[model samples]
Target chain A: MDFNPIWLTLKLACITTLLLLVIGLPVAWWLSKGRSFFKIIIEAIVTMPLVLPPSVLGFYLLLAFSPQHGAGKWLQQTFNIQFVFSFQGLVLASVIYSMPFMLGPIKSALQQLPVSLSQASYSLGKSRWQTFIRVLLPNIKPSLLTAAVLTFAHTLGEFGVVLMIGGNIPNVTRVASIAVYDAVEQMDYHAANVYSFILFAITFVLVTGVFIFNKYQLKSPLE
Target chain B: MISINIEKKIKTYQGQRILKVSGEFKSESITKIHGPSGAGKSTFLKVIAGFIQPEQGNITVNNNAWLDTVSKISLSPQKRMAGFVFQDYALFPNMTVKEHLEYATADNEWIKHLLEIGKLETLTTHKPQYLSGGQQQRLAILRALATKPQVLLMDEPFSALDPENKLALITELKLIFQELKTTVFIVSHNPQELDGIAADGAILSELYINN
Candidate 1:
């Protein structure tokens, strides 16, 4: 069985998860703790990917990534980077697509925490950054793990966005989901089953691992 | 000395009311504050600690203005460096008892001293969930003092302690405060717990009674 798509999918998931963690931590913290008029608007925008059709997001992303258009044109002239039909484009699309999966649980976990924990850290002369990294992040380990697992799994299962933006470029953007679609269209049930089974096993293991870890985390101490 | 003159509008279920307070807390002394619930006692400590912003206020500690609304100069809480023991004993759940003190200060000797003072040396490896209410309360107090802060603000610090533990802890705290020359502000529902530790005839009540 060809495993190029498998490795590509894993690579995309890993990259997307890493980037989302860096991006999601602050966004989730702000959504949960900040007092701003734009809070709801930003939250709505982050969650837009959840309810939005992937094709729609991909179409708009494709337009934005076009080297002839506004963002695309600016990018091409400025840094000579093409986003559409590239690994970078898939990364960007996956980040947007899996944002809610990463941000929602983290925000909820932070919001559930007592306000006093951060305040206590601050009173001990810890800065906001210190409190976030040392105190807040440590307390929300389960949420972080959940966010990572969900984003990785969700990114693995992505089809429409990858289809629209990635366009099934083998070894570059032909992730397992796209590979499976390709296999089916070519009357290759055996290859399709292999891809499907792998994707399914990966997602199932991740989600179940999250559940078990959550159980253990709960039994230990995470309140 | 911590001198505070502040006015804040507190919105409660009853209605909106102004919390106007002004006072000079002496340096290296303990001030006991007991008042009816919803009297902004907690809020006052928060204001002094720079956690809450008062509308019109000036907080000067040792002649340094921590907050001056007129000049729009407000220090962040990290800069304030006030050790606080919250009423709920907001210990980080993920951290062991030792880690809590470690997080506050890198001084191993200081942490050891704090743990001994709180009688938590044996439980240092235990997390908050494994601790009893009194143990948790002591941990909170110990964590606060771990920073060796010049100013210590405590809200109902002994609410969960037994009378015996309370007395012992209070005795230890008095010595700790004296040793550190810390200015202490304590909000307590049980005034008896602070009898000798608090300044004589200085137990202020209803300082911010909203009604």
Candidate 2:
């Protein structure tokens, strides 16, 4: 009946969604431009998370962030940050795991917009940055909302990556998904059911909201 | 004078075709460009507006180099300061009629004058989606003029207007172009669309590009 795991899961999802949104906007915009070999490679890397199993990503992240050697060692010594088996580690893993959910919708929406929109803005003496913020981003509101909600829901339901890199450790790293597995393993059916229902209900509401909002915005120009 | 000697390679459905245009346009005059379909008419306008970069070319506006590939000096679209009215109207769906003009210039009086010229004073609150085709087209033209640009590029500007509205709008635009001394480039399939406006001696020049 401990609610710490639920709170921690919500916090992680919120933080991951925010971080990805800030990072994804520029990356998605760059990718949405006409294709090049370099861009194609970067896009493939970004999209890999969607198709690749979460466990594979988790395994690599664990190795790369382990404090014993490599990047993990440098980060731990220089920044005094330990990514493996820590709450911060869970946040990093969730951001990577939920990246495609955040990027896919925004990228496609940007690509779908008519090129003339930017051209018109530019011809009016608007700079590229000004055009992106004032014109391009405003036209894709529905897609932005969809991306944010999907990233949040996807992060909330994370299991494999969190379990691998952020092993169940009370409030620090024990999110709802990990808590459910721990409860079931301990034969605590009631606790497991509570955590499962909460996670399921939250994700269902988020996804349903996205669908309804998108349907309402079906008449949008970008759609 | 605005002088241009530009050559660009454009990909057409048939194959790769080159668009080569060489012309000298007098400042503050209007030029009507007529060409058949797939003749890269719109592409030519875009190149002058700095939307498309020509492979090798030089564009000098009033003796100031806007683009020179040899020296690698190409001004960005912002620096070029050309106003464009797209064939599709290209109005911002999120912005209202007034916001569009306000986005371009801070002069309230100019915006008010533009609204009256387009006969869109009452529809200032409406978004492009709410406006009819003709209304949207007028808004696009009005928005372009909002910047008070020295150079204006329009592609099929009056395609959606009725004959009555088209003539009226053209009459109003003639006075405004002269008053502002704006250099204008208009592309149209219809040869007679701007007969009187471009037929004025020394004020009009005609150019034709064939695929």
Candidate 3:
């Protein structure tokens, strides 16, 4: 019911959105150009998260980051970071859980671009990396923006993964979705409605924004 | 300035048809490729420009081997140093004339001069979709020239333009090439586009040479 949960959700969305954009750009580019067998395998893995149950993802993440587990123990010993039951842990989990949302549109955009573009840049004597940075990235701006927006909104509304891995620890793991879940469990109708309305409004606006931008982009040739 | 000795094949679903062509393009010349569409005229242009690959061929430019099937060498496109003007324009449809001009380069006083000379100065902000057919073709010309390539490959570059604009562009391009001292290869089904532009000297029937 409180506004604090809403604020927390926004913060999480903003952070995840930025992280996905920073990481997803080059990743999507590689996926676009790669011919390796591992490419499809990795794509399948990324999209698996999209189709997988949120709770199952949370379970695996928790296993990977628990101090008693092999990966978690190694990370804790080397970097002194525990991914389970922490806000940072939640962010990592969310990023992993949402990888497909960012990668798909980006891959599609890169695919739609003609190979002649990079070739054209090359014919001008620019190197491969230069052509990618200068020519290719500029062309895929709309897709990049779309990836960011979808990832942000998707992360904001994430629930099962946050609850399972984050353990609903207030201030540290108590995301707004979890708060709404907690309100419903206690049968507090007013409080539940408040959190629910905020989440609904945020997602509604985000989707509407995507459509608006998409329409404008279609009218323009840039997208 | 550029030379290509290559044998390529266009592999359709049925079978591959070999395209064997070799030639040199010296600076200060306009080379015209004249052939029927199925003769792989455009395909050869793409091979020299590094957009297409030959099954078993060698492509060398300015004493460099870009592709040597016998030697198992395939260089990336960026290293090829070519300028290509597609029959389709291939302009970044979203970009403006200014951006396209900038795409060609900003340092050359000659580029700036060409902008004014071609009368493209006023259309710098216009996108290709908004441009007239002739204007879009000029945009392609502007882009190719900016690359400062040793050789330029054009695929029917003027096929869509009106006579006046096409003639004006050819004039501007010729002047720019003269000043830059560069080599160009233009693809034109029209004898008129090839007639005046291929001023260097005849190398073969329907082909010309500069040196």
Indicate the DockQ of the complex predicted as candidate 1. Answer: 0.68
Quote the positional error of residue B198 for candidate 1 in Å. Answer: 5.3
Better model by TM-score, 2 or 3?
Answer: 2
Candidate 3 TM-score restricted to chain A: 0.94
The sequence of per-residue lDDT tens digits that candidate 2 reaches over residues B1-211 is 8999999999999999899999899999888899889999999999999989999999999888999999999999988989999998889988999999999999999999999999999999999988999999999999999988889999999999998999889888988898888999999899697885754453887899998
B111-210: candidate 1 lDDT, tens digit per residue: 9888888999999899999999999999999999998988899998898999899888887888888889898888888777778565444333333333
DockQ (model 2, Cα): 0.66
The TM-score leader among the candidates is 2
Q: Please list the residue runs of candidate 3 whose C-alpha ends up more than 4 Å from where it truly belongs after superposition.
A: A220-223, B24-27, B71-75, B199-211
**Share of reference contacts found in each model:** 0.91, 0.84, 0.55
> Per-residue lDDT of A97-125 in model 2, one digit per residue for the tens?
89999999999999999999999999888
Per-candidate Cα lDDT values, in order, are 0.89, 0.92, 0.78
Model 1 pairs whose backbones collide: none
- The CAPRI quality class of candidate 1 comes to medium
Poorest stretch of ten by lDDT in candidate 3 chain A = A214-223
The TM-score obtained for chain B of candidate 1 when compared with the true chain B: 0.94
lDDT string for model 3 (A1-223, tens) is 3677777778888888888888888888889985788998988898898889999999989888898979999998999998889888889988998889999999999988987777666777777787777678777887888888889888988998988888877778788888888988999978888888888898899889888887887794543
Score candidate 1 by lDDT.
Answer: 0.89
**Best prediction by lDDT:** 2
**Mind giving the per-residue lDDT tens digits that candidate 1 earns over A125-158?**
8888988888889889998999999999999999
